[model samples]
Target: MSKIKIVTDSIANLTDEEIKVYDVHIVNLNVLVDGVSYIDSDEKIAKETFYQVLKEAKELPKTSQPSIGTFLDVYDSFEDGTEIISIHVASSLSGTASAAQQAGDLSKNHVTVIDSEFADRGQAYQVIEAAKLAQAGASKEEILEKIKDVKEKTTLYISVFSLDNLVRGGRVSRAKGLLSNLLNVKVIFEFKDGVLTPMQKGRGSKSIQKFLDEQVYPKLETLTVKECSLSYVCLTEFLHEQIDKLKSMFQEQVLHIGFTVPTVCIHTGEGAFAMMYYHD
Candidate 1:
């Protein structure tokens, strides 16, 4: 009988303990700053240094998905009869999933690729579920079904205080970014269907806090939340308050708080934070 192995991209934001406990293989993406290319994995770079470099850079750092050759090397490393389940970030977010799929097609071993339709901890939720099911000797179909369930139940939201980085990345027009900065505009986004949809647009940090009080906490109380992850570029005063509230609501034991992926930082800029939940 062939055993199953799990593969995922760097954007999952999985901790070292979880990666080791689950024996997950990570293929990392790259961020090119000036002429230097840095691997965007926790194993490769320190979070403080990565965020600092992003802040100091004169222009937007260019990011690239892992090459197909990298995925092929990982898949081919496994012996024959090994079942490989390659899970990755949303296809709309990056080309990592596409590269994995291309490698799956070319590899001699059997490889199954899945796009989690999410990123950061949201993607991590699905990847971890797949690893757990694989370890229990579950069939591919069973693993797929559970992954589908997790995807349906998991949710991600981001709060941004500025649009400077988005304008630098050409994702937002300079005029809008400038106007937002002058007006102190804040935006909340819901990551749904592999796209970041603007859920609320209001002025100042109070709008962000109001949204959390009136929107997020009430909803979580009604559901059984399995786990929650907090990702941010900086720990602002607002984030500290939110953290206290989260601990009060869900208990600190169930929370994993850390820096988000570098790609996420590049777009959201400083004073941006994300909340991801995996609920029943």
Candidate 2:
């Protein structure tokens, strides 16, 4: 039987337990702040500390995809004849997928690269599924087909309380950010076809919840939800409250919570929350 290995990037938002259980290999991205660089790993800089620093920083940090050399190093670490399935965040979101492809072309071992077309937990779902299938002694073709099916069924919804980070990162204009703050407007975005597009805007948290209830829940009812995960930049009473509500609502589905990665935080800022679900 041929050995299969699962590879993903830090943006997957996988937990330590999940990483250990699945034996997933992660390649870290470079986060530059105040002219200093840090790896996007818990060992290098904790997520809590990163958020605190981001809250105080004068300018938003810049993130760079892992180098092809980094990918090559990981690919070369495994023994010969090992088959690799390298899953990554959306190509439209980052160049990590392209870097993986470049390294795969240069690798000696058999390598298959996949663009998850999602980020955070949405991407993690595909990685975990592929890892599980590989661990079960499934063939490479079977695992790849499962991943492709999951990618097609995944849905990502994100809501941000503040647009400061987006404005600083140039994703949103300063004037619009200020206006949103003044009006207490919360904007929800949906990741579709590998692009993050604005879905709706509400006046406040209450209105946001109303939007979710009216728009999101109905759509979810139409699909056969298999798995769901929630991720947030910071933990708050509101977050806990929402989680409790979701847990009660989706009792049959697998539900989990995770902290957002630094790269995502750099764009959404604090008080950002996202819900990702996979369905058929």
Which residue pairs show backbone clashes in model 2? Answer: none
Model 1 agreement with the true structure over 1-280: per-residue lDDT tens digits: 3288899998898888999988899999888777778888744456655667777887788889999999999999998878899999999878899999999999988899999999999999989898998888899999999999999999899888889887777656799789888988898889987887777777888888888888988998898898988899888889999888888888776888888878778878888999989898
Q: What is the lDDT of residue 87 in candidate 2?
A: 99
CA shift of 70, model 2, Å? 0.5
lDDT of each: 0.86, 0.87
TM-score of 1: 0.94
lDDT string, candidate 2, 1-280, tens digits? 3399999999998989999999899998888877888888845557866678787776678899999999999998999889999999888878999999999999988889999999999999999999999889999999999998998888899889998877877667799899999988998889977877878887878877877789877787787788778888888787788788778868744787768898888888888999889987
Per-candidate TM-scores read 0.94, 0.91
